[model samples]
Structure formats: structure tokens, C-alpha cells
Target: MEIITINYPLQGLEDKGPIRPKTLAIGHFDGVHKGHQSVIRRAVDVARAEGLEAAVMTFHPHPKEVLGRGSEYTTCLTPLEDKLERFRSLRVDIVYVVTFNLTFAAVSPAAFVDEMLRPLQVKRAVVGFDFSFGAKGAGRAETLRELAGSDMKVDIIEPLMMDGDKVSSTLVREALAGGRPETAEQLLGVPFSLRGTVVKGEGRGRTIGYPTANIQLAGAYVTPRLGVYAVMAELSDGERYSGVLNVGVKPTFHDSLPMPVMEVHLFDYEGDLYGSTVRISFISFLRSEKKFASVQELIEQIGADALKARSVLSAFK
Candidate 1:
């Protein structure tokens, strides 16, 4: 898949001469969750039936983050690289990562079409029903269609629901934050995962006979609820191991730290995984983090947690 980082004001495209007509799936696409997958799939279906290039346009830094809407908007469910990977998996031919800044946000609905979509020869655009654009987000999905007129067509997908609840990124976040990864998986159509590199930590786990791989998150991701969970780790070589993942400070030993530490003890695995990239998928919440009275007590509880994690993970297998 071709990934293009289109700068603001849409520069350097003149050299290509006439652009190819394409069908674009445009959105923030934070998680590429079930609802997002539907929109992108529809765009691909439309592109294939119409014999046009299947393309996607996603904004970076999120509009809310750039606009200073709220502090909660700072982190992301999926980073830019992760989002691109999902788009590629959806069989999108091209992905345009548009820079979302103060200047571009000021572009009116009509001007956005006249300046960007028209130039790119976007014949059709697929967006969600609640999609908005332009300064202060004054343009709705209907506004885009009207503004584009004869130059471009628009399709707006309605809200997807599960168990009478809307399937959305916000709901996904809430689920993960509340230690409900099963619900998140239902919304995402896959397990909620965190990717990171194995980093060195204080060799305390090894002394306790429960060696763990300390993880350093790859990017700014929304941290899952702080506690222990049943998780599976996929190494760089594609080996997967089910394990007990802890997402909190070692309350039993240290004082409250500024940031929580993420560490996992994979079952039936023993190797040097330092510097390796591991993707950990949250399977189930085991228990909340607590401060044990003694180190042996903590050790005994961890052994129990391991047994419970193994039992829960077996069903997933």
C-alpha cells in the first residue's frame, strides 16, 4: 500500500500531472474498530465496482488534540503507524496522512473540496453520518455532498450498534479504561493490544522466580485500567505466548510512582527477549493491583494469578 504524507496547502502534486480518479474513505479512524472497518470496507467495495483506486484520507494528531479541546484527547487508541497497518489490511490502495494544524482547520467545507478533493480527482468519498469538517466543524456529511456537487459523490454510513449500544471509539476507550477488554474486543472485532519494546527493569521478578519482560510503549496510547490481566504476547518472530500482565506500580515494594509500569510473565517461556518488539493483547482482567504484606505473600498470589490466567486464556485458544 502506498502511504502519502500530504502537507498542508496540498503541495508537490503538480509534478504528477493528471491525477487518477479514486474513491476515498475519509475520517479520523482512531481505532479502525468495527464501525470504522464497515466504512472502509464500503469504500473499497465502491472503488472495485466503479473501477477506481481505493484510497483513504486520515488526519494526524487528531483535531481535538490540535484544537486544545480537552486533555483526554491527547493519547490515542492507535498511533499513525498502527492506523496505516489497519488501512492496508482493509486493502486500501493509498493512504493520505493529512497534517491537521491551525491553518488547515480553517478551510471551509466548499474550499476543502475545491482545494483538496477536486485536485486529487476524488470521485466518491465514504464517511460516517456524524462526520464534520471546516472551521468549528460547521460542515456535516450532507454539507460535504452539497459542497462537492458534481465534482464528487458522498456516502454516509450510519452508526453501528452492539447490544443496543453504539459502536464507537469513545465506547472502546471507556471499556479499556474500565478493564473490560472483552467488551472492547467485541467493539474492535479483535483483542485490545499494546505494542512495545522489551526493556530492562530491576531484576526483582527473576529473584521471585517469575521473570517478566518490562515493556516501553511504542507511542502515546491510552493506558488500560491499572491492574493485572490475562494477556498474550506476540514477539517479533511471530511467536505468541499467553501470560499474566501487570499494569501498575509495584505497590508492594515501592511508593506510588508517577507512571505505571507494564510487565508480563509469559507462561512456559524462557528466553532473552530484551530489545524485542512484543504486542500484548489483553484477554481478561484478573485482579486489581494491591500491596501485599510480605514478598512471599505477593509471590504466592502471583502463582495463583498465573493459574487463573492460564485457565481463562485456554478458551481463547
Candidate 2:
């Protein structure tokens, strides 16, 4: 799929001379969660039915993050790279990644439609029912439909519900924060994961006989709850490994730090992974992070955790 980055005004930015007439799916799909996928799927299906290209329009540096919202909106579930991969998997023909800054945030609804959507030759748009845009979000789904009028068609998808609650990015984040990756997987149609680079740590895991690779997250990703979890790690070379991951400070030997560190012990593997990149997918919440009375006690618990993690992760592989 082709990716086009658009600055404010969104004119004369395409590599090709003219943008194709397409059915566009518009949203800042952070995690490409189930609800977001539904919107994209509708656009693809509509485009196929009407014989138009399937395109997606997403924003970078989430509006809330750029607008100085609360800290909760600071970190993202899926970074730009992960998000684009999901779009590609959905079979989107093109992706317009509009840069979201203070200037773009000031655009009005009518001006946005006339300057961006119409110029791009959008034949139809698929949006969520609660989607809003323009300065301070003055435009809603109905507003977009009203502005489109006869020139373009609009379809507003309702919220997707699983079990009882509505499936959304916020809902997925909430589940992760609460140490429920299983719940997030249900809402996302797969496991939630983060990409990162493996860095050198204090060679402590090796001394304990359970060597681990310290991981530094690639982007501003929301760290899961402070605990140990069963995980599946994929190296940059595309090799996968089942593992036990810890997201916490080593309280037994050191003082509590400001941020929790991430490290993983890949089962039955022993080769240098330092400086290599890996994507870790959380599979199960094993237990909360705690300080053991002694190093032996901690090691014993870890052995038990590894046994439990192996049992749980076997099903995933």
C-alpha cells in the first residue's frame, strides 16, 4: 500500500499527480481496535462494490496529545508503524497520514471538506458514529454528511460491543492498565503488542540462571500494569519465542525508580540479543511484582512463574 504524508492544507502532497477517487475511512486509529477495524472494513467493502480504491486517512501525534490533554492520553497503544501494518493487513490501497499540529487543529469543518476531502476526490466516507473534527471538534458525523450533501456519500458505523461494554481504544487501554491482556485481545481481535529494542542491563538475570534481555520501548507506548506476564517475543529476524516478561523495578536489590523497566526471559534460548529489536505480545498476567525476602526466594518464585508461563503460552504457539 502507498503511504502519503500530508502537511497542513493537504494540497500538492501526493507522489502521483492526482489522487484517485476512493472510498475513504477516516479516523486516528491508534490501536486499530475492533471498532476501528469495522469502519475500515466497511470502506473496503464499499469501495469494492462501487469499483473505487480503498483509502484510509489517519492523523499522527494524536489530537489529544498535541492539544495538551491529560497524561492519560499521552502514551499510545499502537505506534504509527504498528498502526500502518494493521491498515495494510486490512487491504487498504492507500493511507494518508496527515500531520496533526496546532495549525491543522484550527481548521473548520467546511474548509476541511472543501480543501481536503473533495480535492482528494473522496466518493464515499466511512466514519464512526461519534467521530468529530474541526476546531475544538465542532463537526460530528451528521455535520460531515450535511457538508458532503450530494457530492459524496457517508456511512456512520455504530459502536461495536463485546460481552457488555463497547469495544474501543480507550477500553483496550483500560484493560491493559488493569493487567487484563486477555480482555484486550478480545476487543482488538488479536493480542496487543509493543515494539522495542533490546539493550544491555546489569547482568543480574544471568547470575540467577534465568538470563533476560532488557527492552527499551521504541515509541511512547502505554506500559502495562506493574507485574510479570506470559509473553511471546518476535525478533527482528522474524523468529518467535515464548517467554516470561517483567515490567517493574528490581525492588529486592535497588530502590524504586520513577519508571518501570521491561525485561524478558525467553524459555530455552541463549544467544546475544543485545541491541536487537523485538516485539512483545502479552499473553497472560502471571502475578504482581513484589520484593522477596531474599534473592533465593525471588529466584524460586521466578522458577514457578516460568513453569506457569510455559503452560499458558503453549496454547498460543
Instruction: Quantify how close model 2 is to the true structure by its C-alpha RMSD in Å.
Output: 1.0
TM-score of each: 0.98, 0.98
> Which candidate number maximizes lDDT?
2
lDDT of 1 at 203: 82
Tell me the tens digit of each residue's lDDT in model 2 across 26-117.
99998999999999999999999889999999999899989998777789988899999999999999999999999999999998898889
RMSD of each: 1.1, 1.0
lDDT of 1 by residue, 1-317 (tens): 88888866899976745578999999999999999999999999999999999999999989999999978779888998888888999999999899999999998887888888988889999999989998899999999989878768999999999999889999999999999999999999889887999999998999999999999999899899999999998999999899999999999989888899999999999889999999999999999999999999999999999999999999755
Q: Candidate 2 at residue 32, lDDT? A: 96
Candidate 1 ranges with C-alpha deviation above 4 Å: 14-18
Q: Go through the candidates in order and give each one's C-alpha lDDT.
A: 0.92, 0.93
Supply candidate 2's per-residue lDDT for 75: 91
